[model samples]
Target chain A: MSRTSSDAVVVHQREPFLRGFGSFVADVWAARTMLVSFVRKDLMIRYRGSALGIAWTMVKPLVQLLVFSLVMGYFLGFGDQIPAFGFYMFTGLMLFGLFADQLTGGATSVLWGAPVVKKVAFRRELLPLAAVGGALVNFTFMGVVLLLAYVVTRDFPNWHMLGLAVPALLITVLFGAAGAMLVSALNVYARDVQFLIDVGLLLMFWLTPVLYPWSTVQNTLAENGAPSWAFELYMLNPMANAVVAFQQALWPGVDEAVANAAAQRAAGEPFIADFDYFDSAFATRLWLMVLAGAVCLWFAQRVFARLQTGFATEL
Target chain B: MAADVLEPGVAVSVEGVTQEFSLRHEKTLKGLLVSRLRGRHPVAERFRALDGVSLQVPTGSTMGLIGHNGSGKSTLLKIIGGVLTPTAGQVRRRGSLAALLELGAGFHADLSGRENVLLNAELLGLSRREIAARFDDIVEFSGVEQFIDTPMKFYSSGMFVRLGFAVAIHAEPDVLLVDEVLAVGDEQFQAKCLGVIRRFQQEGRTIVLVTHNMGDIEAFCDEVTLLHHGVVRAQGTPRTVVAAFRGLLAEDERERRAQSAGGRDDPEDPDLGFVRVARVVVRAGSGRPLDAFVAGDSLVVEATFHAERPAPRFVGTLDLYEGGTLLHSTSTARLGVPVGPLEGEVTYRFTLPDVPLGGGRYRIAVGAAPDTGSPPWHQVGDAAEVMVALRAESSGPFALGVTVDRPTRV
Candidate 1:
């Protein structure tokens, strides 16, 4: 190791923001290797004692998909009503899994790292970021299973429609990362934040359109004489809009099934009723959520920086 | 405080630093609520662990911080290490720094020792390549190579700290803050650690060590600071500051004994007798108060006494002790000088023609008793301290002046 010169000196002062946040940014960048090491440690610790090890990442989700397909597809006969119902549900669940894992892991990250945080002086934001990194690693593992399903079924997505998945994935990730940073810092002060996070995630799971299509919710709201603002309020949930976007990108059967229903009705033939799956304002909602998520992420980082000063003493 | 730049050659400069912590007595919500319902509210008490402490450690120099427990020695070290941001004031430090506040504090118990080494090194700001280069040296020094693949939980506590110490020393930090961690491991390993510290000194790396062991402070430190109740009481050469710290400890001990003695009401106890040694002072033969002296100098011990009732025969004994070992002792009875039935106040003095003592701090213990072999009516274990300097050519507890005989071969 070479000697650090006098110009590269470090000053530990209270409220160092006056010296500029640039130094903090530089410090974090300098510790990038430690970030990678922490992410690897988190991933390794999760599977350390398991018999199947990383294979369990694939098996666990595959089993959840099977159980969901059996209960919601075969028993409810939605397998016949909707084309590729299994694919649509699987893609939505995968995205939701990413969001859930990021939130839970991020919120409890500081508590799990009590030893290192209390003992070592480093960029503490790395702890939650590492958790988010670990969750992304798991997301990639599940994506492999989804790709194989697409290959095995021979039902490829519309290449143009698949481009929409980028914004959808960004929305989920931005919100997840933001929530993690905010909750993790708060959790250090009061452990109750994690339990609150658990309840919030459970509520968010049902609010997201994973188990059913967006049209089902739209039709139900219409029948209840709900106002237009009520529908707009539902779209305000970034996770809901992201889920709808992912389905538009990855699920190919919705457009064809809707066209088939219209043609049969025009011929005066007995046809099963089906609603249009596309949302006219989908693009606008996606951009709006993305902009909202950026603001949220910036605010969360500020909150984390403020709270982290107390972490060493409190822990 | 002005943000004055630290002068060149100063590795660490802390100015008017104070650390305040809000101590919460109740941590759980349930416990808090129950206590509040009973009309007891646990308010956060602000405790200042360090109060406006300032110091400068010169680059390439070793500084020792000596203080009693809770005297802010470790807190000051933590502030310098950047482990805890001071509640007030600023710390400016040059070059890369590493703190060995607690050994193996970053280790994961479930991970293998090899994995922990990599992870801990990264946590301490070592790059991957640097760790790879030093990995073998660390393992060899720790002496746990055969069990490197095993989880640290399987290793003994001694092995655990050795591995921690090994990695930290090899980090080659420009400035290292150590908090009494060298006391760990076996004696042989401890010696190895001391050797490493000496090598670091030779390399001109700055080190700030906080320890209670005065021997280490004297042997390794170029400068020492004594802290009492979160403030610096003295700072100077290791010998002078260490002597001042010992004086502080003695004063604290005496105050504690006095407090406890007040609670005891044993009238028959000889310690409560009327005859008492009022004050004791040690000085050189020239009538100067003894701060220090060259070896073999004449010494004078004076004691003032008050007697309400005294026996016909009495004894005034003075003892010179280096630590707990009594080096020399004398009494009026042994000298054939009579200190008889006395009243009111009297002064007793003893003069030694020549003193043969080591180059270390010694304490003067004076006592007054009515009869021989009876409990002392008044005794001051540590009345005054005198520092003796050894001759340049001599070593050990006694400065025995010896002459080498020059003669023809017989």
Candidate 2:
């Protein structure tokens, strides 16, 4: 094993694992229809025979919004004062849900489909991508629920925020596929990875700006002169940009003119002013997330190709 | 005799393929559980599953792959099929190859038989148009038409096998590879599968078959390779290769029971043996084919003598142990069968049908008798192995648990 990560592991002692061009490309591509059918089958099978069936995709997000609005709106005291707090949490929840869903679903796709992986040779990458796509399909219902919420609320969501869907899907998919590729390869050699994902998900859930706002965390870190390692969490956390973008999209002008006025008034004087520095350029965060997602995806492709050779025997 | 023309192009070529497996021994069950749960270094040890295996299959030729268990027969097929990648070696294929190493490798249970047909056909590189054109024929051939709409999870094992086989043969590839899938279908289905293979043979589609069944080997293969312990021990025509296979089986019997060849001293393995040890071995036919047993073929048992000094007149008992328990046995003392005087190297040729035995592994026990005064024959050594094969089922003795009780006197 090389110290640095490599996509290809050309083992010369034995016959190569992914030997010929016909199998490497054609085998994967030949299974294109199979991949589509399998992805469709997975979706059908997942929601099959259930009372709500796929309605749960929308219902789950709506239910979260209803309960959060009651608790965060009345109890926590951030009611109408913070623009659209209900929409704020809904956007965060939707984006965050995508990130979590992609990672969990994609990460386990290969292991979950060990039957196909071990028994035959097709594109192993398709398994995880199918998972990402399944979550993507479920996004449609969630869209309807978000639209319904926007109609019910007075705050009109701007058309600019509609861009979040594509980038969110792409970024979440890239990160999700990367995570899945890495974890699926790792899980073949270790059976206890399910438990590892359980812990990792729980920790990352609170760490990401899902239930709360980034302002909450940024305010805490700004109080201390030394910016913490937690700052990099924004870069690494896949949901941070998407979630913040959604909140910015649904709730227009969240941090209003008060902070800018105060900053200009205090600028000539020898006093520092508190303003929304990170907020001024929050849309770029989603773009950065897209870039990060692509990077992870590229990294994942290389990693998976190298490690996938070990899967047949390892499984 | 069949024509011996091989097409110019190579359908499949394997060059210097070697597959190594890491056998984790340092981590026993206890160690593995301890380390894995504790998050320590996972233990692994290297094992060479395949070593320097190379072969070529010219287009439009029937090649037979024969090997004993653990001989890398399946591994080689998987690599050729691209289901498995070799740790080292290169496999080159010119055109599309439909590898049937295991039938229905990609079938889904939740999908109906009809649905699976499309999925499986598409998987075999068939276009939707092709699958649609062949749908009715595939359904009719599978004979699962009535149950086509039922989820495959509800399919009977035989129905599942039929559907899989139906989809596979219809897919039609330039190179067809078949493993032991014929064993799953009924006699009629097996015959039909063989017929399909014969058609492929006639069409000049390359076919490589891996089967323990000599019937399949003799019937279909124009060329054969016999493998032993991951090495090509023999390669030639079926007749010559099978003869070599029998020779290898006999050699394997000899190697396996090298310990109990009528031992002169106390057997050292305290754990495996202690009961006045003797020997164990299988009676081989003239050619010594492990998979060759016929209705009245004369089978011979070769044994050497072992006894304590001042040899007692011990009765020679041959008990057949099947599945670790005695099924039926005979002794020289209780002879309806004849037992001649003992010599240095004794050989007994018993008619195959005389034993009324079924198929399976039977241990040969040759125990010694004591003089009338001595304890009724202290046991000598106790180890011998024999397998009965029926011409009907060359895969091996199909008699799984059919035990014959010695005809008790009325």
TM-score of every candidate: 0.83, 0.73
Candidate number of the best TM-score: 1
Off by over 4 Å in 2: A1-32, A152-155, A160-168, A224-236, A251-286, B1-8, B25-44, B263-410
lDDT of 1 by residue, B94-196 (tens): 7877777755546677788999899888887788999999999999999999999998889987888888888778888788888887767888898898998
lDDT for A9 in candidate 1 is: 44
Model 2 residue B279 distance off true place after TM-score fit, in angstroms: 27
Query: In candidate 1, which residue ranges exceed 4 Å CA deviation?
Result: A1-5, A8-10, A13-25, A257-281, B1-4, B25-44, B103-105, B263-410
User: What DockQ does each prediction reach against the true complex?
Assistant: 0.39, 0.15
Say which candidate scores most in DockQ. 1
TM-score of structure candidate 1? 0.83
Give the range of the ten consecutive residues with the poorest summed lDDT in model 2 chain B. Answer: B266-275
Candidate 2 accuracy as lDDT: 0.64
- How many clashes in each candidate? 0, 23
For A88-180, candidate 2 gives per-residue lDDT tens digits of: 777777766766676667666777676556555566778777776777777666767777766776456656556655666666667876787
Write model 1 residue lDDT over A1-315, tens digit each, in one string.
344346434456444433435555686688887888888988787898889987776676678789878877889776676778888788888898888888899988998888777667777888888888888888998888778878998987767788779989999888998999998998887777788899998898888778766666666787789987787777678999888889778886767767866886788864344535445666776888888987777677777877887787888
